[model samples]
Every structure is written in C-alpha cells, then in structure tokens.
Target: MRNSMHHQAGFSLIARVLHWLMALMVITMLFVGAGMVATVSERHAWLLQLHKPLGITILLLVIVRIGVRWAHGTPPLPSDLPLWQRLAAKLSHLALYALMLAMPLIGWTMESAGGYPVILFDGVTLPALVEASPGLYSTLRFMHTWLAYTLFLIVQLHLAAALFHVLVRRDSVMPSMSTGPLPGAKRSKG
Candidate 1:
C-alpha cells in the first residue's frame, strides 16, 4: 500500500520539470500576447518579435510533453473521487492539450495568411503554413483572439481545480507534480 501510494503521489522528475517550465512560459506568453495586442507603439513590434518565437517554442515543447505523457502515463485520480469530477478532469485536460496545440498553429497560420514572416531570430524564417489572403487572415485573427480568451479561462479553471484538490479535498493530485511532499501525505518510516 505504501509503495503504491508513493507511486501514485509522485510524478517523474522530468514530468514535473516540464510541467513547471511550460506553465511559466505559457503564462509569460499570455501576458506578452496581451501587451502586443494592446499597443501600437515600438513596444508592439518588440512584443511581436518575442511572441512569435515563444509561441513556436511552446508548440515544440507541447509536442514533446505529449510524447512524454504517452510514454509515462499520469497517476490515476483518487479512486474515491466523484465520477463527475473525474469526467471534468479528463475533459479539461483534453481541452487544455487541444488549445495548447491549436493556439500556436492558428497564430502561425494567421501570420502566414497576413503575409508576415515568422522570423524566429536573425536570418531564421519559418515557412508559411498558408498562402497570403486578407480574408483568411481576418478570420484566423478572430479565432486566435477568441481561443486566447478560452485558454485563459481554462487555465484559471485548471488552477482552481488544483487548489481544490490541495485545500478542500486534501488529496494527492497536486503533490503528484509537486517537488516536495504535500502536507498530510504519509511519510514512510526509515
């Protein structure tokens, strides 16, 4: 029982590292994106430069993350968790992965459609995903904006759920990805 519980309560170190790293990057990207859209000054250009490469980086990381997840499955939810909660957890994760993937692709395509080069850095330009079309660019821009809003809301919900598991239910969910043992977790005798 102790061994099984320990296994269930901890994520592999690589998984934890990836989780925290991507979380920080995603949060930073969100703010940078907001700043980019809200300004028309020189800052906007600077932010745009940052946003493009960051988005691509996130896209690449998420692909690697998905591969890791597939190779090493996540810890199971507490067996006693309510069915509704389980369903919600699964659905929310699916949504998160989908959005994480979709947002970058849409942004890349939008830029392509707008006839803008996706320059990662000096002399490094990504090929366009779509041909330039003003109409398509407009449509994709609308999608990218609404999807960003949706992603923000979902991220909030994910955070709330993690807190609920830690504070309200006093469960192992958060500790699975936590570097340190969560309060109330059992420690084996040496």
Candidate 2:
C-alpha cells in the first residue's frame, strides 16, 4: 500500500533555529516567572530583572518567526488526518502565537504600571508605555499571572497533540515541527 503520509516541505533552517531558540526562551521564562512570583528576596529581584529582557527578546524573535512563516508557506498536514483535527491544529497554533505575543506586552504593561524604568541587558533603558499607577499595576500584574497559567495549559495541550500525532497516528506532525518536514513532503530549497 502506498503511504498516505506525505512529508511536507517543512520550515526553513532559519525558522527551525528560531523555533528552538524561542522554545528555550519561553521555557526559561516560565521558570523565571514562577520563581519571581514565589520568592521574595534579593534573588527574586535579580530573576525579576531578567524577565523583561527575556520577554523582549522573545517578542522580537516572534516577530521574525511570523515574518518568515509568511514569506515561506507552511507544509500541508497529513492527508489521512480528519478535518476536525486539522482545524484544531490550526487553532492551537494561533493560540500559541497569540499567547506568545500577549505575555510580553502584559509584562511590560505591568512593569509600566509599577513605575519602574525597564532596563535592558545593561545600561539601555526602555521608555514607559504609560504613566505608573497603583491600580493599573495591580490589575496588570494579576492579568499577567493568570494568563500565564492559561498559556501553560495550552502548551501542554499542544505537546500532547503532537505526541498523539506521532505515536498513535504515526503521522509526521511532530517531526514536521522538529525537523521541518512531514512524511512525503518536499524540503524547501530556499
């Protein structure tokens, strides 16, 4: 029997690199974010300071990833996959990107409300998005934290779906993401 599984021309090398890099950054942010909330001390302050820079870096990388995705179309899903699964796949990805964008802005807004200068790696400082206010600071901080939990759940779902595709379906969904090619899909030469 001919394999219905087609390898999609997966993401380019640039996209793969950016994907892994952003993955690392996001994972680190999750840990750092949790630590920042859980602890109250000199260590917490140091970690909290790392949050802004890391968030901004992810923001910039995400922008680039979006651009690259647009420039180069993504590979098609496996033919055997049901329509509902395809739709869910698309929506899940959309949610991931939305959360990726939202988290950083939420952090920035919270910091702006807290009345602190957003220092970059060192020496560099970012202008405040808005004037500092006690009420807004508290509100944004709460939003950032709650949305983080939501993002966490969504990420777990995403991972589970990928594993499902790989193990049960024996599809290329997971590999397409990891290596940028699905079964029977052509690799982009560009």
Candidate 3:
C-alpha cells in the first residue's frame, strides 16, 4: 500500500515538488523581468541574460506540470466550500495556466520581432518565432508589459487565496500541496 502521509496529503510527491519548484522559479523570473526593464545599467544586460533562459525554463516546466495534472487530477476542494469560491478557484487556475504559457511565447515572439537572439546557454539559441519588424516588436513589447502586470495581479490573488485556506479556513487545501501529513488527518495505531 502507498504510505498514509502521501495519501492524506492529496498530491503526489512529484506534483508537490513541481508545484513548489515552479512557484519559486516563476516568482524569481517575475522579479528578474522587472529588474531587466527598470534599468539601463550593466546589470540590465546581466538580468536580461538571466531572464531569457528562465522564461523558457518556466515555459517547459509548465507544460510538464500540465501533463502531470492531467495524469493525476488535482484534489477536490473542501466539500463545504461555496459554489462561487469554487468557480473562482477554477477560473483563477485557468488564468494562471494561460499566463504561464502565453508570457514566454509572447516574450520569445517579441524578441524575434526585434531581431534579438534568445540564447539559452553557451552557444544555444532558440529559433525566431516571427520575422524582424520594428512595428510588430513595438506592439508585442506593449502587450508583454501589460500582460506581465496582469500576471502579477493574478499571482497576488492566488497567494491571497492560498493564505485564506491556510490561515482563515484552516482547511486541507494547503496540505494538499504539502509533503507533510495533512492537518487533523487520522493516524493508524499499528
């Protein structure tokens, strides 16, 4: 039989690890992106170098994460949760997934339109998604910046909802993604 802690925690070990890993990577990428845009110093170049590969890594991980979620469905919400809250949860998750996929693609396309290379590492570069065009680059740059702002807002809301589950609701929602045993879960006295 599978271990009780794993069962009680709701999410598989791989899922929980991926969740936390991607969360950290995404948050770091957001900060790096903000820094990259906010300066013209030498540090801007360094941050840009960091940003490209990180965004691509996030794009790849989110794809894998979606596959895992599809294979091993997410745990159910609290049974007593209201209908509106459930709907909000579903919509927010969908938005998150959409942003995860869109942000990297748009960024790559923007770079392509600007005639810039997306170098992942030593001598590794991604192919251009679109032909070079200043007009298209300008449009994509605007969209990328605005979409980044939207992503930041959605991320904040997601954090607030997670905190609500942990602090206010004191529910299994938080435990579902945790590696530890679920709070208040029954233990066998073997």
Task: Quote the lDDT for 129 in model 2.
Answer: 89
lDDT of 2 by residue, 13-54 (tens): 887888888878988898899898798888798998898899
RMSDs, each prediction? 4.1, 4.7, 4.6
Error of 2 at 29 (Å): 0.5
| Model 1 misplacement above 4 A | 1-8, 180-190
Indicate the residue-level lDDT of 10 in model 3. Answer: 72
Tens digit of per-residue lDDT, candidate 1, span 25-60: 888888898889898999999999999999999999
Q: On a 0 to 1 TM-score scale, where does candidate 3 land against the true structure?
A: 0.89
lDDT of each: 0.84, 0.80, 0.84
Model 2 spans with C-alpha error above 4 angstroms: 1-8, 187-190
Clashes of 2: 9
lDDT of 3 at 91: 91
